[model samples]
Target chain A: MAYSNAYAPSAPELPESFVEQQLDGENRYHYAYQYQPTQQFSSSSVMFPPETHPDIVKSFESADRDRSGFLDESELRQALSFSGYEGISDRTIRFLMFIYKNPGDSLRLGPKEYVELWNCLAQWRSIFDRYDRDRSGKMNSTALRDAFFHLDYMLPTSVLQLMISQFDDGTGKNVELCFDSFLECGMIVKGLTEKFKEKDPGYTSYATLSYDVFMSMIIPFIVSYD
Target chain B: MAYSNAYAPSAPELPESFVEQQLDGENRYHYAYQYQPTQQFSSSSVMFPPETHPDIVKSFESADRDRSGFLDESELRQALSFSGYEGISDRTIRFLMFIYKNPGDSLRLGPKEYVELWNCLAQWRSIFDRYDRDRSGKMNSTALRDAFFHLDYMLPTSVLQLMISQFDDGTGKNVELCFDSFLECGMIVKGLTEKFKEKDPGYTSYATLSYDVFMSMIIPFIVSYD
Candidate 1:
């Protein structure tokens, strides 16, 4: 597949050779390598585009033991595990529900939403694998920056540093982010930016918010997640 | 003043000598050392306990330059600096307004709320100082834990570790928290615990929450502050 640079016009410029290297067949193979599992999953059981996948639908129905047409937290937990994401944290699950649920919906996930969430997770997993350059199941600061750049988020250096320190695994001297932390960090940046954009509709990067407005807008983001 | 152990029944037991050591005149002197400024501020212009302090009231009136009887963000920023807390972050100031303002009040602070806020800052400053064992203006993980213990919050070790890593200054190998980070860390733990307590009124350390309740409660804390 051809890499598209059209969406990332604001992305910081890099050396021409570096751009070419990233687009070369080897790197394309890397993307393909990480995406192979999803392909296999599609070919073996159901079609691609998880929204229509029979396995996902079956998993959700089976996990919804109460047959309420919605999966509660515990049920969602089981459903996600069945979809190969085991031991997902309660905080992450809550975050997922917050982002994907339809308006007027409770915290639970209906089948359609669950399938969409499964697709989202698959995308995040693919991103994680592509950035885990050493195959250590973690991304160092440089890899993290590159991954976000690939995703079209030109985060400031200070913000990137904050994310690194906030999500450091405490293993040792080196800072690294596992898959879950990467997801959380990315979602937080995306969510906060969206909130800020609401106040700065002109994309001016400046917003004047009354304290109450600021608190009301930010408090939910701060309090609800891990 | 005599040290009180009466409020911290759940605090981890220490050697009798260690307890005595902490209560000795030297440690008491350390507390007094940090408290000296507030004492001087009280004696020179107004009394302590802050609420009735003439100086605090005057500061508030001066900060309310518009004579609106409330201090907006910029005015509150100046007022905090006047009270010796220089360069307070906008996030911290908003958090203070969230905690101190009356139910119907807007983001700005009235005279009564300003005075109360000053008192609260003094208390937090004292806590930060007491735990900054080497007078380094920062607290390490151990000091951070001990400070919470002294405050009657027996946070689990895992939670303490999370606080340390989350608030690390990134200066070097050591994880140290400066005063502002300390204040944020303590407030987050206290705020989250209070929210959790509402659902676990029996103090059972367990609560059953629907996904909606969990997200609504936790998101505010996650989103609003730094």
Candidate 2:
């Protein structure tokens, strides 16, 4: 089973001191440590690039400094506080609790768990940015409407206002939407507006149209008349 | 079967005589000729109530001049080109011809058609007004982005830009979107970007999540690496 340089590329057991070369472009796994979402100027428009969540990986990687993947309370607390969470915000670590779903007290997530966290957090962040069209650190009625249109195809102006109202939490009775309450909702499509608001003939309903395919013929499927 | 009116409710029929009755409030057949969409706005929101077209049948009554269900070319042209179409120059009309599927056809629309037209044109108007968030009628990049975010997601920014770029046409590119374009294209989605740009990985491609449901989740689908 002896091998030469051509057959093995390098000594099979030379890892003790051999230096590895990094590839050009995205091939570098290091990229997993520096990803960021592209800029978005408006909710009506989307500016996205691929491969987000590098920062999350960097943090998680740091928490798992020993490369053992799983993090104990100390590592978890450090990661949590670094991520902008208070020491004990929800009274329970949902992420850790989630890992315990398989039963037993084995709630620790290792490297694989860390990767999954990055993926989820990364996408959630992106969704938040998408809704915040102005990316001025806030989203407004127009941005949310644009998002709703892309989402369903049914947002009567009133229903839209209601969705905005839910997040308004302002002193003014006439509350329009902005980025103010975004963080409150966790950035995921947790409780998006229903398909339509049921109303009579005079009742208004608008379907939120987001994506498209095939021909450009406008397809206004009343996802729900209600 | 003959039906009798309890209180001689003004018949859905229009009086052929020149009647100056106030038409009373809550008149089913003619509530000041108000359309829900048009009525919801404040004086500041819209440019002006779309001039009731000559053939618009403000009441169940026919047009005093045209006597048609939908206004004829002359009547609609007058309505569309009124002070509403104010600065629109002839050169602007020429450009609109290329952008719209059937631009040169006689300028006329029925009630249903007018609704479709307003839905699209009104959105563009909002963009213009949004740039003037303070309603100052001027804009900067911040204003532009905010206006853009406020724009419908299905609206194509490039197409909008093309329309504005041609503004120097002297005639003013005030070609309001008519019914045909809407039934044919503009109605396809909310904003133009949705028509083009590739899906960002930031999003879950909500197309995948509820591929069978609707597009509303697309915004939350974008993953924020930032």
Top lDDT prediction, candidate number: 1
lDDT of 2 by residue, B47-138 (tens): 22344443323321222145443444334444445425433323223212112211112233445444344344555554465455565444
The weakest ten consecutive residues by lDDT in model 1 chain A span A24-33
Best by TM-score: 1
- lDDT for residue A142 in candidate 1, whole number 0-100: 93
All predictions: root-mean-square deviation over Cα?
21.9, 25.7
Task: Look at candidate 1 and tell me the lDDT of residue A196.
Answer: 50
lDDT of 1 at B49: 39
In candidate 2 the C-alpha lDDT for residue A167 amounts to 43
Q: Docking category for candidate 2?
A: incorrect
Alpha-carbon shift of residue A155 in model 2 (angstroms)? 5.2
Looking at model 1, residue A156 earns an lDDT score of 53
